[model samples]
Target: MQIKLIAIGKTDNSNLITLIEDYTKRLSFYIKFDFEIIPDIKNVKHLSEAQQKDKEGELILAKTQTSDILILLDENGKQMDSVAFSSYLQKHMNSGIKTLIFVIGGPYGFSNALYNRANGKLGLSKMTFSHQMVRLFFIEQLYRGFTILRNEPYHHR
Candidate 1:
């Protein structure tokens, strides 16, 4: 299955982009991977948190197909270790899914509509992380998961 990471806003830090790119490249060897950045909503000062999330949710939903399996990277979601996550990925791959979409929401988090559309949610950590930083962390964990599956040296016990 093709794996797609959809995140809100651009990543301004060049260092983070470079690291994210490195992992993205490595992940390509194992499975088809795509990273999509949705432009940040404008005039956020005029809109409430819920409004911003509503707008972002519209944009996020537009990028997806009805058949795509959507997973949100949420704070209140299931937290899995690297090995378990690797198994999770394997299970999805075995399921004959067309596309697996993992979304990183905006600063205000996801809307109720978006949450309802998701097949599952995954938490990277209990502590909060910036949206940009989460992209790197998720990509790295994806790479690590693939390495573990392949019995590679990238992830050590």
Candidate 2:
């Protein structure tokens, strides 16, 4: 299965972008992984938190396809260890899904439609993080998970 990361905004920091690229490249060795950045909504400063989420949610939904499995990288969702995370990927790959899209929602979080559209949710940690930073963290973890799955030296218990 191809794994894609769909995030709401761009990563302005050069350092973060470099790290994200590094992990993203490493991930390509194990699976077809791509990070797609959805452009930030216009005039978001004038909108309320709910409105911003709704607008971002529309962009998120637009990027998804009917056959894709949508998984939200949310804070309140289930948190699993590295080993279990690898097994989770194994299970999905075995299920024969065409594409698996993991979303990093906007700062205000997801809308009702996004929540309903998602098939599952997985949390990285309880601590709050910027959307840009979460992109790097999640991608790195994904690379690590695949390395662990292959019994490679990239990941150590």
Candidate 3:
């Protein structure tokens, strides 16, 4: 299955972008991975938090197909180690899924509609992180998960 990461905004930090690109290149060896950045909503300052989430949710859902497995990177979601995450990835691949889509929502988080539509959720850590930083962290973890699955030296238990 193809793995896709859909995030709300672009990364302004060159360092983060460089690192993300490195992982993306490495991931291509093991799987078809795509990273999509949905542009942030305009005039968001005037909208309430819920309104922003609704708009962002629309953009997020638009990128997905009915057959895609939608997973959200949410703070309250299930947290698993690298090996377990690899197993989760394996399960989805084994299920004959067309695409495994993971999303990083906007600053305020996902909307009720988005949450309802998700197949599952994952939490990277108990600590809060900037959305940009989360992009790097999640991509690195995804690459690490693949390496572990292949018994590569990149990830050490």
lDDT of 3 by residue, 20-114 (tens): 99999998999999999999999998999999999999999999999999999999999999999999999999999999999999999999999
lDDT of 1 by residue, 63-107 (tens): 999999999999999999999999999999999999999999999
TM values, all candidates = 0.98, 0.97, 0.99
Return the lDDT, model 2, position 135: 95
In order, the Cα lDDT scores of the candidates are 0.96, 0.92, 0.96
Higher-ranked by lDDT: 2 or 3:
3
Candidates in order: C-alpha RMSD to true structure: 0.6, 0.8, 0.6
* C-alpha lDDT (0 to 100) for residue 137 of candidate 2: 89
Model 3 bad stretches (over 4 Å): none
Between candidates 1 and 2, the lDDT winner:
1
